[model samples]
Target: MEYDIVMEPPTPREFVHLRSAAGMRERSLDAARAGIGDECAAVTIRADGDLVGMGRIVGDGATVFQIVDIAVAPDHQGRGLGSRIMNELVSWLEANVPPSAFINLIASEPAFYEEFDFETCAPELVGMDLTLPTESESSHAQ
Candidate 1:
């Protein structure tokens, strides 16, 4: 199936649904609504008018940037949609971001991103993250 890739962020509902459908972690609708438009660059791919793939670049935009939320629906995987999304993202970064900006991404499959020249920041630097507890979890703990 052919897809229409656009240089824009997905709607919050579409963003939440597509991420889950792509086997990624679930994110709250509130979080989606709050965060979707904060990206410096975003790509959305749709088929038959349904959003099927997306990628985003988020950060301070000037000196720091992180690629995030790259996803493609399960049924649409392996058709090079991810590559298309990445191509749009890399192209946007190349055209818009400054040469001195620090761009990064956290990937489970480093090999996939390596195709785009993303190297693992190991040895010299380690990737680390911390997920904050939800409201319910915090209340239960208290």
Candidate 2:
């Protein structure tokens, strides 16, 4: 099916639902609502006025920036939406962010990210963390 990908800033409600549908555990409705107000910017693709894909950039706006919440609804996958989102993101970064700024993302699909010049950290520089913090001895918390 043909889709008209519209790129625009997403509403808080749309951000929450799309993040959830994308299986992103790091973001929550409250967090997105709180963080996406001014500094962060997002681009969403709508087909016939219905949201189908989205991508977002969140950061302190100077030294650090991370791409987050790139998602396309299941029925809309494999149709170049992902690439469109990444292209928009990269363009934004190139236009606004400084050369010394740190741009990063935790990609769900490593292969896809590589297409946009994102590479896995070398073994000596790799870092990983759990989205949920552990504060107890026996049980994990989210």
Indicate which candidate wins on lDDT: 1
lDDT of 2 by residue, 27-141 (tens): 6667677766564567889888778898888899999998878898887888899999899889889989989998888867899999999888867566566655434733643
Error of 1 at 124 (Å): 1.2
Give one digit per residue, the lDDT tens place, for model 1 in 1-142: 7789899999999999998998898999999999989889999999999999999999997999999999999999999999999999999999998999999998988999999999988989888988899999999998
Weakest ten-residue segment in model 1 by summed lDDT = 120-129
Query: Would you list the C-alpha lDDT of every candidate in the order shown?
Result: 0.93, 0.79
Give per-residue lDDT, candidate 1, residue 77. Answer: 91
| C-alpha lDDT of candidate 2 relative to the true structure | 0.79
RMSD of each: 0.8, 3.4
The TM-scores, one per candidate, come to: 0.97, 0.81
lDDT of 1: 0.93
